[model samples]
Target: MASYWRTPKPGRKIPFIKKSPVENPIMEPSIPTHFRCPISLDLMKDPVTVSTGITYDRHSIETWFEVGNQTCPVTNNVLKSEELIPNHSLRRMIQDWCVANRSLGIERIPTPRIPVTPIQVSELLSEIASASRRGDRARCRELVAKIKALGRESERNWRCIVSGGAGRVLSASFSELAAGSFDNSTSGVLEEILSALAACFPLDEEAHWHIGSPESLNSLVLILNCGDLAGRLNAVLMLKELVSSLDADRINVVADTDGLIEALVKLIEKPISPQTTKASLVTTFYLASSSEMTAVKFVEMGLVSLLLEILVDSDKSMCEKALAVLDGVLESKKGRETASDHSLAVPVLVKKMFRVSDMATGFAVSALWKLCKNYEQERGEGCLVEALQVGAFQKLLLLLQVGCTGTTKEKASELLKLLNGMRGRGECIETVDFKALKRPF
Candidate 1:
């Protein structure tokens, strides 16, 4: 069926644009040399003139500043002020060029947006606070939408909103929703509030506490259980930030909260995007490291088997996170026993070392040392034989040769001693002994 879009004026004729079933081919047009950003060397989408009078792509120059570079990328001149003025004239010319080449599939650039000042964001937050005190949910949500729009505009706007205390204010608005205000009509507001909070990261310490509140966390758990994929992803992301900000005691409080553990485990059991999966993994690590009870709770929830599954089939990024979470889980007795009982636990942990990353290898070694060392004491030489069967000794040896962190090297050495003793393979703890072991056994 053909489709048509109407103009905003009801009396205007409808234009037939027949939505193409497939994407239009994007072609590279010869952009004018002056249209290119000095830093990025690409046709600028959002050109902004910096303090040094050099025009660059907004995102590219912002990145340069973000990495602690205060001088102009082109001139090497020290920036006197960090202000970014939109190069509206250049941007308009770029857009005109794009439109002129529209037949070649070039899309017009969007108008550049100016980031709100900290003062403006602060005033908006004050309005939300007043709405909250007045119990005005409708007005509160409207103000939150405006903030959300600002965040979606650009990274600079988001930084302004976050530094201006959007995380604190939005979380407060969410707390109000958590107090029995959730319903079909308010789910939009719920997701908007949570999504906005997810963007306000690297939050101040005071903002962290407000977002990690008991009521706020419980509400997130509810979203994790039944919310749509987008909402659930946002919930897990917000939880990751919340957990990252918490200490052991605060983490313990989150762990003891009803339904939170199960909800987080479900996030992993059913994979969303890699992002949500990673966030859930991080959130669980904080929970497991809080106390033995929480770790046991994760083990009881079948988290051990799930993490092992992740280790077996996931990519390097996921494997690294799964290993870290697994290492944290092994701090508890049940966590260790559960892992030891799983057939893939030892072999998979050995397989990950020297392949993923230094951090991953560190977690893998720690988890293996705990599992095998504990089993050596409790289940006799059986675990040692299993480690040898999976070539744990060779992998650990190679790990040390390739270099690892201090703690990983220490754990790898101890595991090597145990495995070498099992195989009648002789080697001391030092690096030279590992090199000498290549001559038969």
Candidate 2:
């Protein structure tokens, strides 16, 4: 019998067989048809059935309504109602699917949260109104707590509250309470009102009208002065929003409020948190930007030193805002005098030129330019020498070389020419090493 397998002869040519390559088929996980949303074509987390008997994710349907889509996405039929009914069975099935596919990296969806309804919001507002009318502080507090709770629950609830007129009602309540004679005993009510208002952020223009009143503005300033940290933060933020939206006349009215500037200054001087500090700075910027008088008030309130302190310690954003406020303040002669008097004034401005953002660099350069231009003619060589001593020349050169905004570059060039001409003319008594000023990379 011939051997089934034969060994090849040593050093002899052997016949070889070539086999085709085999590929393993890839298997993709199959997703249940019902688990997919018709609109988004993704697995649904919170499924809801619309009036057209088509199911979609809650957020998708709500977004559809927001975009003014009145018909079903699948059928194109006009929806009789926009009411969304939770598809609990579908949601449970999807959750079960996720659990079963845990080994495939599918995460189990958490229990769906119930959003606040318009009817619930309306009832809370009615109860709050009743309590407020009856002068029932305790009851009012309870009801206000409920409103706040709903607002804080989720962004969806916040929209529901705002849509249901809770923002308007809260603003009107604030105005009403502020207009009346409110003593220390009523501070709790004020705190609640402010907290509610802050939670309802971006108050409507109608609410802004209520918050912009003299009574409301002054009451907020009072809260800044005497309220707790939480209340003060809300009060300052509310004031910032109101001030930012007010007209020139209203901003002037706010500027004229006794102790308003002082209150903001106090917040900056003794900051409870970085948030409070930033809000105070923004409010001051808004006020100062309103008019020359408002700018003067900031300088008169001794905001320069506090601002310098904040600039030294704050991050880039805060530094930018603080510099902006300082720029506004420096528009006034008295403002320049105040800033120039601080020990870190010139040095701080010079250091911040290339260190912070381009916007900050613009503000810092503008501030220094303002100081030098304003006092250069009157104070003569002293101001130029001061700038030179603080490395202003080097910073400006670095600023130009590094490149900044067009306006900023133009300003820097102008300032650099002015300083160089003064130094060439021997107007600057102090000697500055131009080469040494160039920063080493």
Provide the lowest-lDDT 10-residue window in model 2.
14-23
lDDT against the true structure, each candidate: 0.80, 0.80
- The residue-by-residue lDDT of candidate 2 on 104-166, one tens digit each, is 777889877788888999999888777666666667777888888877767789888887898
The per-prediction tally of clashing pairs is 0, 0
Candidate 2 clashes: the total is: 0
RMSD of each: 11.9, 15.4
Using all chains and alpha carbons, the TM-scores for the candidates as numbered come to 0.75, 0.82
Clashing pairs in 1: none
